[model samples]
Target: MRAIDITAPGGPEVLEWREVPDPRPEQGEVVIEVTAAGVNRADVHQRRGFYDPPPGAPPYPGLEVSGVVAEVGDGVEGFRPGDEVCALLAGGGYAERVAVPWQQLMPVPDGVSPVRAAALPEVACTVWSNVFMLARLRRGETLLVHGGASGIGTFAVQLAKALGSRVVTTVGSAEKARRLTELGADEVVNYREEDFADRLSADVILDIIGAKYLAQNIRALNTGGRMVTIGLQGGAKAELDLGALLTKRASIHGTTLRARPVDEKGAIVRSVVDNVWPLVSAGALRPVVYAEVPMAEAAEAHRMLDSGEHIGKILLVR
Candidate 1:
């Protein structure tokens, strides 16, 4: 199999496609002949040596993939060779093949192509777990999502709206703001020109710009609000105003999907397949892909994501 190997921690240029040993499934796992992989910020972090795969996981950078099942291990049921599926992976998605636990596999939703399915797992699980499950965003409540045009943000906006929540999002430009509003966001804050905290108060805030938005995110929270921080695009350290938090009776929760145990990831995957897939099948939610590049051009895909020139996900296809 050919996989993208990080020669050394640095930039996208360091990614090299090279021959690697084929992966065989362990018990309760299945081997997938990967057709497409989603590019994410975490992949870039791994490529730059900032994030490491969990112990006993693959070393490659991808986190989600779609493909046909090639083999299934002992104890694995409900999947067979030739079955098409998408999966949440811990790593090793930038390859022609990957080994995934059966629990993380989801059948491609009706009317969704396998290529597009590759972009759903990571974003779906991330948003559903953090915003819906953890933050407990209820119907009719205002949910604020930072980085509104991003893979996670795009999915969050649509899913929250479909579940009856009023959505607000922050983006870097007017164009992105318009796009997000069309996707069901009630309000779009142009972060470059306007302060998000000044424009709206939210009952639940899904934030990606960690530290830089910490203080303001608190200020923007409605009383008893819950804020979930999933990314650190804006550095990791910041001072929290305990007084403000106490006054508002608010709480902040920080989370990441990658380092979790397999069973926990499996639970999230199951929740997504059961709850979110139906919305996708009904067209209330959809995968937003910006570009599709050949697997060998993984480096260029990474470069495009780093440039922040794309609105949604960039996929690497076999």
Candidate 2:
């Protein structure tokens, strides 16, 4: 089998595809002959040596993949050889084959191809966990998403809208704002020209930019608002105004999907399958693929993502 290895990580160039030992399913796990892998910003961070795979996880960077089951380990049921599935992985998705816990595997929704399915797991679980489960974004409430054109942001926008939330989102360009509106955003803020916090008050905010938007995010929240920060693209350190939070009765939650315990990640994956998959199957939600590159060209995929030139996900296909 061939897999990507970060050889003294520094940039996308550090990702090297080379022959590696094939993985076998462990108890409760299944081996997948991967067909496609989703490229994520976390992969970029890992390639740069800023993030490390959790203990006992594969060193490769991919976090989600769609593939055909090759083998199932003891104690695993409901899946077997030849089952087409996608999985939310802790790491090691950037390969021809990966071994994953059965709990993380999901049947590809009807009408979605394995290539597109690769883009769903990470974004779906991330959005479902942060915006819906953790933040409890209720129908009719105002929800704002930063980086609206991103994989997570796009998924969040559609899911929140389909669930009856009035969605608002911020993007870097007018073109992206237009696309976001078409995707069901009630309001779109061009962050390059307009401040998102100035014209919007949200009951729930899904923010990717951290420190740079912290104060503004708090100010933009309505009373009793819940703000979940999932990415720190704008740096990690920031001062919080306790007075403002107290007055608004608001709370901020910082979370990451990668380092969580397998059981916890499995729970989120289950929620996505049970709740979100229907929306996807019904076309209320869709996998937005910006590009599909060959698995061996993952470095170029990373460059495309880092350039921020593409909207939605960039998949690496076998």
Candidate 3:
């Protein structure tokens, strides 16, 4: 199978597309003939050697995939050899085929195509686990999402609004802010021009750009609010105000979708399959894809993401 591997630690240029061994299912795993893969910031980190895949995970970059099952291993049930599914993977998504644990597979929701489904797993699992499962976002509350036009942020906005929460977002441009509003954000702050904390107070904050926004995210929260951070797009090191956190009775939780256990991710996937998947199928929430690149152009996809020239998810079609 053709796969993208990091030749050495550096920039996107290090990512090389080459033919590798085919992925075969081990016990309790399923081999997916990958149709599409989603590009993410973590993929960039992996190429730079800042992150490594866990034990037993694929060495190549890729965190999620949409494809059809080609083979199933022992102990895997409820999925056949021809089922169309999407998986939240630990790595190895940048390939023609990938072996994913059965626990990570979920049916492609109605009205969603394989291309669009490729964009769902990472964002859905991330937003559901952090914003809804962890933070417990409530209706009538104000939710602030950093990187509003981003993959996770775009999904965060739609999900927040669908649950009847008021949505706000901070973005790099006026155009992106406007797009966020169209995607159900009640207000959008130009982070480059405005202070998000001063512009709006939120009952919950779903942040993807961490550290750089930590102090201000705390200040922007309402009393007894929850702030769930899932990324560190901005520099990771920052000071925190212990007094301010205690004063507001706020709780700050930092999580990474990829680092969680398989069982935990399975639970989250089940939750989405039961609830949120229907919303997407019903068009209450929509998949936002900016560009669809061929699987061989993994490096270019990474380049586009690092450049931040696009909005929403970038899907690499196989």
The C-alpha RMSD in Å for every predicted model, in order, reads: 0.8, 0.8, 0.9
Clashing pairs in 2: none
Worst lDDT run of 10 residues, candidate 3, spans: 228-237
Badly placed stretches (over 4 Å) of model 3 are none
Return the TM-score for each candidate structure: 0.99, 0.99, 0.98
Name the Cα RMSD for model 3: 0.9
lDDT of 3 at 260: 77
For residue 102, model 3's alpha carbon misses the true position, in angstroms, by: 0.6
TM-score of 1: 0.99
lDDT of 1 at 163: 98
Task: Give candidate 3's whole-model lDDT.
Answer: 0.90
lDDT (CA) per prediction:
0.93, 0.93, 0.90
Each candidate's number of clashing pairs is: 0, 0, 0
Candidate closer to the true structure by lDDT (higher is better), 2 or 3: 2
Over 4 Å off in model 2, which ranges? none
Please say which candidate is ahead in lDDT: 1 or 3. Answer: 1
- lDDT, candidate 1, 92-193, per-residue tens: 999999998899999999989989999999999999999988999999999999998999989999999999999999998878888898899999988889
Clash tally for model 1? 0
lDDT ranking, best first: 1, 2, 3
